[model samples]
Target: MDGPSGSGKSSASRGVARALGLRYLDTGAMYRAITWWMIEQGVDLGDAATIAARSHEPVLTSGTDPDGPTIHVDGVDVGEPIRGSEVTAAVSVVAAVPEVRARLVAMQREIIGSGDIVVEGRDIGTVVAPAATVKVYLTASAEARAQRRTAELTGTTVEAQQAAMATRDTLDSTRKTDPLSMAVGAVELDTTALNLEEVIAAVLGLIKERT
Candidate 1:
C-alpha cells in the first residue's frame, strides 16, 4: 500500500493483512526508527551530510505480524519512541535524505522476499516493491486525515495536524528518490468517508479477486 501519512495506510493495511493471513510491514515506522536513533545519538537533524553518512549505522528490525507489528533499532523496541512528537517532527527531514531511503528500501525489500506480506509506505508500490501483485494507493480528504491523526498526536489540534501533514506531503512527494505517487497499475481507493471495516473489506476484495 502507498499513501501519505494519516491516509489510513498503516491501519487499513494491517487490517487487510490480518484478514488475509498475510504478514504486515510498516515502512514508515522503519524511517521513524532511524530518526529516533539519530536523535538519541545527538545527530544534527538539519545536517544532511552527517545524517547520510551514518544512515546505515543503526540496525533496524521490523516484525511482520499483522495483528501487532513491531520495529526495533539496535536491539531496543522503538515502537513507542518512534511515534513521539520529536521523532514525528524530524522523521520527514531524515526521510528526505536519499541515503536513508536507500537503506530502508533495501530492508523493506528483504523482508518481503520471504513470504506473502502487506507493506505500507509512501513509495512501496512505485519503488520498494514495484512488482507487488496487489498495489493499492489510498487517499482521503485532508480534513478527514488530520482528524484521524489527532487521536494519537497529543497536544496537537486537528488543524495543526492537518497543516503538519500538508507540509509532510509536499516534502515527501517532492523528494529526489522514490517520491510518493501511485504506481502505473495501482488501484486508487479513496477513503474520505469510509470506516475501518469498509476500507479493509475493499482492499480484501481486491486481494481476493487477484487470488
Candidate 2:
C-alpha cells in the first residue's frame, strides 16, 4: 500500500493484513524511528550530509504483527516516541535524505523477503517492492484526510493538521530520492467516502482479482 498521510493507509493496511493472516509492515514508522534517533542524538536536521552520515548508526527493528505492530531503535522500543509531534515534524526531512532511504529500503526488502507481508508506505509500490503481487495507491479528500489526522493526533486542530499534511505531501512527492508515486500496475483507490472496513474489503477484492 502507498498513500499520503491521513489517507487510511495504516488502518486499511493493518485490516487487510489481519484478515489475510499476513504480516504487516509500516514503513513510515521505520522512517519515524530513525528521525527520533536523530533528534535524540542532537543531530541537526537542516544538514543533509550530517543526517546521511549518521543514518547508519541506528539499528531499526520492526515487529510485523498487524494487531500489535512495534518499532524499535537501537534495542529500545520506540513505538510511542516515534509518533510524537517532534518526530512527526521532522520525519519528512529525515526521510528525504538519500542515505536514509537507501538504508531503510534495504531493511524493508529484507523483511518482505522473509515471507508474505503487507507493506504500507509512500514509495513501497514504486521503489521498495515494484513487483509486489498487489499494489494499491489509496487516497482521500484533503478535508477528510485532515479530519482523520486530527482525530489520531492530540493538541492539533484540523486546520493545522491539514496544512502540515499539505507540506508533507509536497515534500514527499517532490523529494529526489524515491519520491511518492503509484506504480504502473497499481490500483488507485480513492477512500474519500469509504470507511475503514469498506476500504479494506475493496483492497481485498482487488487482490483477489489480481491474483
Candidate 3:
C-alpha cells in the first residue's frame, strides 16, 4: 500500500490483512519510531547530516499483528510516543533523509521477506517493495482526508491537519530518494466517498481478482 497521510492506508491495510489471514506492517510507524528516537536524543532536526548519521543508532522493531501492531525503539515500546504531534511534525523530514530511508527500507524489506504481509507506507509500492503481489495506491479528497485525520487525533482541528498533510505530501513526493509514487500496474482507489468497511471490501475485492 502507498498513499499520503489520512488516505486510509493504515485502517484499510489492517482490515485487508486481517480478512486475508496475513500479517500487517505499518511502515509509517517505523519512520515515526525513528523520529521519536531522534527527538529523545536531541538530534538537530534541521541538520540532515546529523539526522542521517544518527539514523542507524536506534534499533527499531515492528510487531506485525493486524489486530494491534506495535513499534519499539531501542527496546522501549514507542507505539504511543511516535504518534505524538512532535513526531508527526518531524517524521517527514526524518524519513526524507536518504540515509534514514535506506536504513528503514532495508528493515522493511527484511520483515516483508519473513511472510505474507500487508505493508502500508508512502513509498512501499514505488520503492520499498516494487514487486509486491498486490499494489494499491489509495487517495482521497483533501477535505475528506482532513476530517478523517481530525477524528483520529486529539486537540487538532481539521484545518491544521489538512495543512500539515499537504506539506508532508509535497515533501514525500519530491524527496530525492524513494519519493512517494504509484507503482506501474498498481490499482488506484480513491477513498474520498467510501467508509472504512467499504474501502476494505474494495481492497479485498482487488486482491481476490489479482491473486
Candidate 4:
C-alpha cells in the first residue's frame, strides 16, 4: 500500500490483510521509531549524515505478529511517543536518508520473506515490495484528509490540522528518496467520500479479485 498519511491506507490495509489472512506492516511506525530515537538522543534531524549513522544504532525492533504489530526503540515501547507532533514533524527528514531506507527495507523484506504481507507505507508497492500480491494506493482530497486527521487527534483545530497535513504531503512527495507515489499497475482508490466500512469493503473486494 502507498499513499499520503490520513488517507485511510493504514486502516484499509489492515482490513484487507485480515480478510486475506495476511500480515499488516505499518512502515510509517518504523520511521517514527527512528525519529523518536533521534529526538531522545538529541540528534540533529536536519543533518542527514548524523541520521544515517544513527540508523545503524540497535534501537529499533518490531513485533512479528501481523494481527497486532508493535514497535520498540532502545528497549522501550515508544509507540505512543513516536506518533506525537514532534516525531511526526521530524520523521520525514529522518526517513529521507538513504541509510534509513536501506535498513528499514531490509527489515521489511525479512519480516515478509516467507509470509503474506499487506505492508502500508509511502513506497511499499513501488520500492519495498514491488511484487506484492496486491498493491493498493489509497487517496483522498486534501480537505477530507485534514478533516479525518482533526477528528482523530483531539484539541486540534480543523484549519491547523489541514495546514499540517498539507505540509506533510509536500514533504512526503518531494523527498529525495522514494517519495510517495502510486506503483505501476497498483490500484488507486479515492476514499474521500467513503466511510470506513465502505473503504474496507472495497479493499477487501480488490484483494479477493486480485489474489
Error of 3 at 63 (Å): 0.5
lDDT of each: 0.92, 0.95, 0.92, 0.85
* Residue-by-residue lDDT tens digits, candidate 2, 28-101: 99999999999999999999999999999998999999999999988999999899999999999999999999
TM-score for all models, in order of appearance: 0.97, 0.98, 0.98, 0.95
What is model 4's C-alpha RMSD?
Answer: 1.3
TM-score ranking, best first: 2, 3, 1, 4
Error of 2 at 171 (Å): 0.3
Q: Which stretches of candidate 2 lie over 4 Å from their true place?
A: none
The positional error of residue 43 in candidate 1, measured at the CA in angstroms, is 0.7
**Candidate that would win on TM-score:** 2
Q: Which candidate is the best by lDDT?
A: 2
State the lDDT of candidate 3 residue by residue for 140-201, as single tens digits: 99999999999998898999999999998999999899888989989999999999999999
> Which consecutive 10 residues in model 3 have the weakest lDDT in total?
124-133
**What's the CA error at residue 131 for candidate 2, in Å?**
0.4
TM-score of model 4 vs. true structure: 0.95
Question: Which TM-score value belongs to model 1?
Answer: 0.97
